[model samples]
Target: MKALTMARLLIRLFGVVALMTLNSVAARAEIAIAVAGPMTGQNIFRGEQIQQGAQLAVADLNAKGGVLGQRVQLLVGDDACDPEQAVAVARKLATDGVVFVAGHVCSHSSIPASKVYEEEGILMISPASTNPKLTDEGGANVFRVCGRDDQQGLVAGNYLADVWADKSIAILHDNSVYGKGLADETRKQLHKRGVKEAMYASYMPGKSDYAELVSGMRAVAIDVMYFGGYGADAGLILREANNQDFEVQLVGGDSLTTEEFWMVAGPAGEGTLMTFGADPRMNPEAAEVVDQFRAQNFEPGGYTLHTYAAVQAWTQAAEIAGSLDLMAVIKALRTHRFHTVLGEISFDQNGDVTAPGYVWYRWTKGEYVPAK
Candidate 1:
């Protein structure tokens, strides 16, 4: 009787073990996706936007049974906007079997990391890396939901020529890939429009005081300054300019879209002009998603919707292709137009967005609005 009882107990234990193993295998069968960015750096705000956007995208997709009928596993990687760290994050995500990635916001991080995704057969869709070389020089696996610096530069340059033509235009860059590229593009457009800037300079970023630079600009009597850099540095420059009692019209690229600009410059940021894509949150098609974001007490601003749209495009392509193969998705993305928060959009041969470009905005009372 004791031997029989022990045999029955052993059978029950084996059955439990087998069921646990099966559950583990089932969990592993889901498709893995990731969102990577500067999650822990000074630029952590950008990462937060991407992370939140990806979270909603994945959640919404999963609610519909995910792509190809496989549930999606979402992973988050913090590259801190560093090139090497971005590559490391890419590799780690690849090893974890992530087939799709929707991040690496900074152009500096996105370009190098694209090489890794290319080698590892992962698809990457950047939401805010605007440096043209990202798509111009990257593998076919790379794509972006945002407009390029060249496109943004053209819009800014034409505005400068048309509106501030007689002002002594001063163009400045921060020596980073995004900054310099945007400055060069703006300068190029100015030249094309027969406008010559009074001062063109490069400055080191992350410096606290730009009083010396401000004094130099004051000496030149720069009327309008176009800074192709992030918000903090632009704010610092403007603040320094204000300190010297030298008020100038400050303009910047899309990087100034965040409130970080205002938080840094305060009242000095008033009347500052910037170039950004038309706000997607105001889109009629995005009403449901925007409402969903607000229900969580979060505002879907800046690149948040762009990131969401990137995931939307990828998932829609994968769904249409009925597979998650990199080439299949790429083909699907290129050949098909995706209706996203950004509206109907498709990619050109260079993997650049074939959509309409950028528009101008002006800061007033700590917020930005469409500029006339």
Candidate 2:
């Protein structure tokens, strides 16, 4: 009887140990990834794009058995496009055990957040932070799926100098890192191409009135204007110009790609031109995913597809490396070509995508289409 009781106790103990082991394995089966951006404040649209893209990517990857046989869990961080807030978000993501981050869309936010990611050994892939300093000053762990401001600026400046050279031109900036940096690059390229701007000025962003700036442009008889700012300020400037019966052609950077610009400028936004990567929605490879977004009533415009492609690139790199280890994934990113919705993508040593140069687009009938 005593021997039989001991045998029963040992059997129960083995079953308990097996149950705990299974629970431990189940807990470790999920891999955490993060998407950080300004989920609130003025640039919330961009953050929404980031969130949607990341969420979709996570869902699709999990449905396909995930990466490295582990399910992916996506965590979102709201930096509000503020630098200090971005750092806090980054630290939280690091603490949350995310091995990768796809975010902090604003250059100012990404630059500071990148340092935190570096220290915490988190890999970062920015989908829309274009300021060159993000890569110029960033650690090896940082990468961007978007073109740099310098690249986009060259396209803008040269287009202005070549096509609109006969017209009087003004260059204006909002003085933020992205705005000023892009403005300076465009200015540099214009100067290099022997074009002199009629007016160069800076304006405070987020103001309701830009009538005084319009007055200045009118005074100079500026026929073309290049604005280095987001859609909100750009819309106000255009509306004010239209109110004053000013007919200058408005040109801007990628931030003008959103429908908010049209919402703000109304009919005045009709002729505005901006530079951005060729529309990803028009890509044949993105048809399935684009349809998925449309079915959910989301337009995968602006940086939405870019953010999706960022995750795609990370997944491909991890697969190529055969591991999710930070250094292994970094090595794979540096050396492998990724087949993404953006087409085939490879990274340069600075972690910038090697495909898709910036192209011109013009607003027409409430939408931005490829320029003729």
Candidate 3:
């Protein structure tokens, strides 16, 4: 009888061990994270940046043994910078079980997609969207690595008023949330500085011809133009103005920092000025990664490093929180300062990065550099 009892006890112990092993295997399966942006369309370059940055981050993290002992997997969503498509992408990612998302580059897309993410309990960290309403009206799960339009607008407006006060200035927007919001903020600051815009207009984006708009600017003899739009539209406007033989200087927001601007404007992009955070590729901490990017023949320009920093911040927060639980990670993000390629980054209550304010950059020789 004693021998039989001992045999049963051993069998029970073996069964318990087998159950625990299965659980451990299930836990180590995979952890999904997503990166979304305009992977197709006119803005595909920015999407490529987002993909490459996030891809590198995932590879590096997995090499070091991914978060919480599970291998990290990346899901790429192409919103194409469209608001409806962004919503669809967000839903798909949420359904795919991604705990975090770093994406939706356009402000219009980011704003709408944020609602879906919030409802699905997924954390979203936008690497490029800069409109203030993104944070102001966003839920706790939403965050951004880039500075707001208002902040950048203040810089642009002040710079214009201080340096081009004597020149006839015009403000133009693409009628999107990002473009209009930036233009309005710049206009506010310009008026506060006692500078009146000679023309304030909205132009439809994605059109090939802006000749009518160029004609209007020419008629007003506008010497300085502040465009609150993307590089594509801005480049077209510059090309059209130049084709009309109009000598107007163009200043814009961070969206103009891409090579697409030069590709579209050619010689017209020369001397174009814009505002963006100090380039992360120039950061000492980022030298190794930048070298890796260069070795791959990819220039980590525009929002590339920003997306990488977003992933870095998210992983650090998860490590600090000790779990991927949404609330725990959110608390960790709010309380801890993350050391990123962009330098030390901390978040405010509204989920905006507290480091690296906007600065001036100029397009010259087919690339943008710190403006002289």
Candidate 4:
């Protein structure tokens, strides 16, 4: 009888050890959140911002014991802001079993990557892609945490109409997806406000000389300009306009809200006005995250707040659905209001959040501040 009792106790101890080992394996199993962006090239800073924002989100999630009682992992890919590369990265992320994704920060990158995500039935949330076409593609799986280009354009147009009503304005764009889309929207809104411009011209990106465009504006006596493009073209235009003595108040979208814009445009960017979707410092709930980012010496920009909101939305959806299924999470994300650093967020039918969060900012004293 004693020998039989000893054998039974040993078997029970072995079973317990095996169960603990299985639980350990389950706890370590990774649920990856893929992060894609222009990790190389001229716009690398934008990709860095995306990575920083997502990393910060993952850290915060893990600090709070993570999602579904498992730690979150980030799998990053370099899309380089190229459309084809974006699609490839999306495919790779899908193959890697990445259920939740954040980014492909550029409009050009996000549009194509979104197609891949849609095909794979994977959920993707973009932090910075503002082109209307991204959400207009009719894919329910794709969502944007940032404001659409039309929304941002309206903000810029309203600012011009109210602040520089007496000034003659000209609209310029690089004819790219982001540039042309925003410029056209601004033009429509500006026309509605009866602020007709002196000239509306399309310029090719990376041109060394904008002399003809600048001279045409000079002839028209354009007093204020609304440019729709990235910092490179905007910087060139500012330099060439200055060379031709064409001084005007320049206003643009969130693309101009970067430190690189100021560095490239020099003093010309000093008075430039722009718009951003979310402000991190303004939110009370984001104070701890902001302090944490500053401690790590990371410059969290507009995308940082949006990325945090994306993670929050996903975590909330997971809890609501009680599953890690992508489709269920997407459904929950569309219908449920998720609390974020930017306040409560809920998506409309078009996968764009209906929030009155857009604000106009101007560069003053080396910092971007809203016009009082």
Residue-level lDDT tens digits of model 3 in 1-372:
999999999999999999999987875588999999999998888899899999998998999999877789999999999999999999999989999999889999999999999999999999999999998999999999989999998998899999999899999999999899999999999999999999999999999999999999999899999999899999999999888999999999989988888999999999999999999998998998899899999999999999999999999999999999999999999999998989998999999999878999999989999998
For each candidate, what TM-score against the reference? 0.93, 0.94, 0.93, 0.89
How accurate locally, in lDDT, is each candidate?
0.91, 0.92, 0.93, 0.82
C-alpha lDDT (0 to 100) for residue 28 of candidate 1: 72
Q: Count of backbone clashes for each model?
A: 0, 0, 0, 0
Give me the displacement of residue 48 in model 4, in angstroms: 1.5
Best by lDDT: 3
* CA RMSD of each candidate after superposition: 2.4, 3.1, 4.9, 5.4
Query: What residue runs in model 1 are displaced by over 4 Å at the alpha carbon?
Result: 1-24
Q: Candidate 3: which pairs clash?
A: none
lDDT tens per residue, model 4, 107-200: 8888988988888888888888999999998488888888998888887778778877888889999877888899988888888898887789
Q: Which ten-residue region of model 4 has the weakest summed lDDT? A: 363-372
Report the lDDT of model 4 for residue 44: 76
- Arranged by lDDT with the best first, the candidates are 3, 2, 1, 4
Candidate 2 — worst ten consecutive residues by lDDT sum?
A: 336-345
Task: Quote the positional error of residue 170 for candidate 4 in Å.
Answer: 1.5
